[model samples]
Target: MKPAAFEYHAPATAGEAVELLAEWGDEAKAIAGGQSLMPMMLLRLTVFDHLVDLRRLHELRGIRQREQAVWIGAGTTHSAVGRSDLIRQSAPLLARATPLIGHAQIRNRGTLGGSIAHADAAAEYPAVALTLDAEFELLSPRGTRTVAAADFFTGMWATALEPDELLTGITVPEWHGRRGFAIEEFARRSGDFAMAGATVAVGLDADSRIDRCAIGLFGLGPGPERAHHIEREVLGSHVREVSAEEVGRAATARLTSVPADLHGSANYRKRLGAVLVARAWQRAVEEATDD
Candidate 1:
């Protein structure tokens, strides 16, 4: 398979990248890591006239930790984030979710920003980003603006990014050492796209009652959806004594008519969704206790 004819431009700086995107508009697409885009290009699923290579941009290649949050460069690879000492120690739920993305080779080349921009409904980054309430930095010729993760994904393979916008980086609140988190996905193999997935992030108050929680799940909707009903159900109780199965059932029931595919029937996926959510909640509770 071969990609359609396209101009390849590697820019060494974010400014150059945005300028080229401004020049080419819809004909140009940003290429960072190429873990997802390259395969699509080979299939001719996307016909780009220009690929603004972002690999050489040193500025978009590292993770930074601030007192309040963590900044991940758009060009940072999944492997990098998974193995990063800073991310593993501080935002480990992210590190936990990365390996679930794909195999070693794919992880080695996939960029966090690229995955979020791609917005695959079955992908890990989207759910993780949503779980963290992350914000994106999208750059265009006019300027840069931040978009909340919840407002980023519009639908399958779609985002709020404009035609000329390039996602430069993401900012996520630091874990704050008060939460217990878990990520679980059902895939055919070790690195296959998730058939169903769930991530639970919960914070406990001094009374051990759930204070706040975020549940991000995928493979049952147009995009990742927050399990608000489930979170609310658990917020006033201790996870150990709460009826997690009931919460899981309610959450799974809401996805009764999920879209189906060769990997799973809608019913089967719904079942997996319930199971994953339950297990993730259990793990989160244990971790919260330990914390």
Candidate 2:
């Protein structure tokens, strides 16, 4: 099957793209990279009367360091992100997670913003964004605004972005001190989507006490989720005294909406999620302690 006939508009600037979106309303879809959207369109899973191509918007395609955070343009491809030394240094979790997003071909054309906006619960980028407390920049005719990662993802394939808005960039705050980040996922094969996964970031005080921790889970719920209860449970505890297995259990215990599908049952995913969390926690803690 082929996508429905649609008028294609390649806009040179983001303002023009959003203007087209505003004019077409729900009938227009802004495309970047087209890794995800093209497939959906090809399958006829989604249809748009107008396709707003953002490939020519050069402003949305760079990686830069701000005063305290790393700002990545929305159009930056996964391949570019994976190869960025700046990203590896300032936002290691995002860098490490890049290779896990499908194969090289997909990463070559898949944009970071496209993945985040698509909001697949099983994708690595969304979970990493949530774990790092990244902020998203949105542009519309009304003006630009920022939304925190936690508040941006609303539901399955849904986000806080309005119809007329365009995601221009993402800001990931850099963590200082004895900090460690790790991402673990259980995929059946190297390029397969994860059945369950977790991204962990830990910050330890000089005395090796857990000062702060963020655990983000994916492929276990309707959208990427933060393990707030588990985070609170481990704070202030000495790293040696914290049990990775117990933390994993606590992380999955509070999840009320783990998804069940052909791959696994809800209970099975929760179990896998627990194991991934434990693995990720242990790796993050080891790195933090080694520092």
Who wins the TM-score comparison?
A: 2
Error of 2 at 100 (Å): 0.2
> In model 2, where do residues sit more than 4 Å from their true spots?
none
Model 1 lDDT tens row, 164-259: 888988988876545788998988888888989988888887778888888888988888988888777777786567866876677778764487
Query: 102-205, model 2: which lDDT tens digit per residue?
Result: 99999999999999999998999999999999999999999999999999999999999999999999999999999999999999899998999999999999
In candidate 1, what residue range of length 10 has the lowest lDDT sum?
A: 238-247
| Pairs of colliding residues, candidate 1 | none
Query: Among all windows of ten consecutive residues in candidate 2, which has the lowest summed lDDT?
Result: 254-263
